[model samples]
Target chain A: GDKVKQSPSALSLQEGTNSALRCNFSIAATTVQWFLQNPRGSLINLFYLVPGTKENGRLKSAFDSKESYSTLHIRDAQLEDSGTYFCAAPQGGSAKLIFGEGTKLTVSS
Target chain B: EAAVTQSPRNKVAVTGGKVTLSCNQTNNHNNMYWYRQDTGHGLRLIHYSYGAGSTEKGDIPDGYKASRPSQENFSLILELATPSQTSVYFCASGDAGGNGQLYFGEGSKLTVL
Candidate 1:
């Protein structure tokens, strides 16, 4: 079984639309981190959460440890956002993070 | 910003040959990790290190060996490469207490024939 599972394995959205990606954790994850892999193949750290919500420019993320899930919301999507979104959680008492399969998102113009 | 850099951005190796991927972090983080990403699967951890002189096997460590000669340097060694081992390898560094907050490198693409 997968320790971390993400919903909507693939998604397509139009520019200026809003969308959300979710990750459900089967492990007792205390924290969550979100990453964006761009078309150039660079993994960019978007958010790191600890059982709470965080909002960045055009992006917001929430992590619920008790519920064992995390969500990332993107507002006014852009073509540059086309790539993949991944959420990861650390193994209990270890630095090794288990990652989700990733949500492949494509934002069209 | 945390900077994690990987060497040999792209490489092609033969089967049964040796391959080494290097990672360096300038953030002075105590923890470093190596993971490989395949087409349909998520990035899987192959090995991790805690500070200098310590390396631990991760979930998939069978064909991979890791070394942490210094706090800023970590390397992943493949004794005998195989086509199944061809994937994009990423190196990350994070603070000891940062939980899972990791900064990743650009990733090294390895192709084994």
Candidate 2:
């Protein structure tokens, strides 16, 4: 059973458009972290949330523990932003994280 | 900022042979973890450690073994390698409470033939 599940398995966007990715958790997740695996296959940390919202550049993320879900919003998408996005949360009280399947995003000019 | 490095960026192993992937982190964080990345599966936890000299089994630890000799070094051992073991392995370091976002290495690609 997957503790975290991501929606829209894949996405395509035009340059300068905005898109949002979502993750639903089946477990009691206290915290959430978002990561982006770029075209080069490097997973870069995006945002770490605890029931609130955080914005960085063109990216914004929010987590709601009570709702058991999280969202990563990408604004003004660029070609370089094309990649897979993953949202992760810990299972119960452990330090180990359970990850979602990931959303493959492609932004074309 | 945390620094996590992985050795042998790429490796190839013959079936039934032994393979060891090494990782070192200089963040001084007490929590470290190893995960594997596959096409459909985002990332699966293989092993983790709270501190030096301690290794804990993760969700998928049956075919893999882990060793944490010190705070800076952690190794994942694949004894009797199999083709199914081929994947990209990642090493990460984070705070003990696990609230901090994990700092990751570039990743190590291992191919088992």
Candidate 3:
């Protein structure tokens, strides 16, 4: 079984539209992080959450440890956002991290 | 600015050959990690380190080994590369407190033939 599961394995949204990505954790995760893997294969850290919500520009992320899930919301999508979005959480009692399969987001013009 | 760099952005190896992937971090973070990404799968942790002179095995450490010689350097070793080992390897560094924020490198693509 997967320690973390991401919803909507693939997504396509139009420009200026809003969309949300999600991750559900089966383990007792204390922290959750969101990353954006660009077309060039570089991972850009978007948010690191303990249990609350965070917002950066048009991107907002929320992590609910009690519910064992996290959500990433993107507003006004752009072509530059066309890539893969991943959510990760650390293993219980260890520094090791577990990641979701990732949601491939493609924003069309 | 925090930065993590990976060497030999791309590599090709023969079956049963030796392969070494290196990572360097300028963030001065105490924790560093190695992960592999393959199509259809999430990023799988291969190995990690707490700090200098410390290394720990991640979930998938069966065919791989790791070393952290210094605070700024970490390396992943593949003693006997196989075709199944082909994947993109990423190196990341961050604080040891489980802050959830990890600085990642550009990733190294390895092909085993």
Candidate 4:
């Protein structure tokens, strides 16, 4: 079974709209991280959370270890936001990260 | 800033040939990991090391071997390459606390014909 699961495998949104991506962890994950893979294939770390929530510009993320889930919210989506978003969970006592099947986002103007 | 680098950005090998992929991290992190990303399977860990001379099997360790001869370098070896082993491989380095925040290298693209 996949320890990490991502919702909305693919999504399309009009620029200026908003969308949210979700990740569910079956393992006892202590920390979660989100990454965005751009069209050029460069991966940029978006956010790293140890439970609770954090916001940066038009992006916000929340991780609830007790509930075993995490969410990434995109507001006022821009064309530059188009990419594949991945959420990873580092299980307890393991330095290896288990990644989710990424959610591909397409923001059109 | 943390930096992780991988060598031979691209490689092509024939079946039964030996291939090696190398990774180096200047962060001096205690943990290094190797993962392969394919079309639908996402990224699957192949091997990881806790420190120098320590290599451990990951989720998909079959057909792959790893070497961690030093703290700064880790290598993935395909002793007998096959076409099915072709994929983009990424090396990442992280601290010892199991944090999900890992610094990754610009991946190495491998093709086994």
lDDT of 4 by residue, A2-95 (tens): 8999999999999999989999999998889999988887678899898899999999999999999999999999999999999998866578
Worst 10 residues of 2 chain B by lDDT: B94-103
Best by lDDT: 1
True-contact fraction in model 4 equals 0.70
Give TM-score values for chain A, per-prediction.
Answer: 0.98, 0.97, 0.98, 0.98
Candidate DockQ scores, in order? 0.77, 0.78, 0.76, 0.79
Q: What is the DockQ of candidate 2?
A: 0.78
The most accurate candidate by DockQ is 4
Model 1, TM vs. native? 0.98
Worst lDDT 10-window in candidate 4 chain B: B94-103
The digit string of per-residue lDDT tens for model 2 on A1-109 reads: 7789999899999999999999999999999999999888888999988999999999999998999999999999999999999999987778888899999999999
**Which regions of candidate 2 deviate over 4 angstroms?**
none
lDDT by residue for model 3 (A1-109), tens: 9899999899999999999999999999988999999998889989989899999999999999999999999999999999999999988747888899999999998
Tens-digit lDDT string for candidate 1 (A8-108):
99999999999999999999999999999998999999999999999999999999999999999999999998999999998886888999999999999
- Model 3: which docking level applies? medium
* lDDT (10s digit) by residue, model 1, range B1-113: 89999998999999999999999999899999999999898899999998899999999999999999999999999999999999999999999953947999999999999
lDDT of each: 0.94, 0.92, 0.93, 0.93
The fnat of each candidate, in order, is 0.74, 0.66, 0.70, 0.70
Q: Residue pairs in steric clash, candidate 2?
A: none
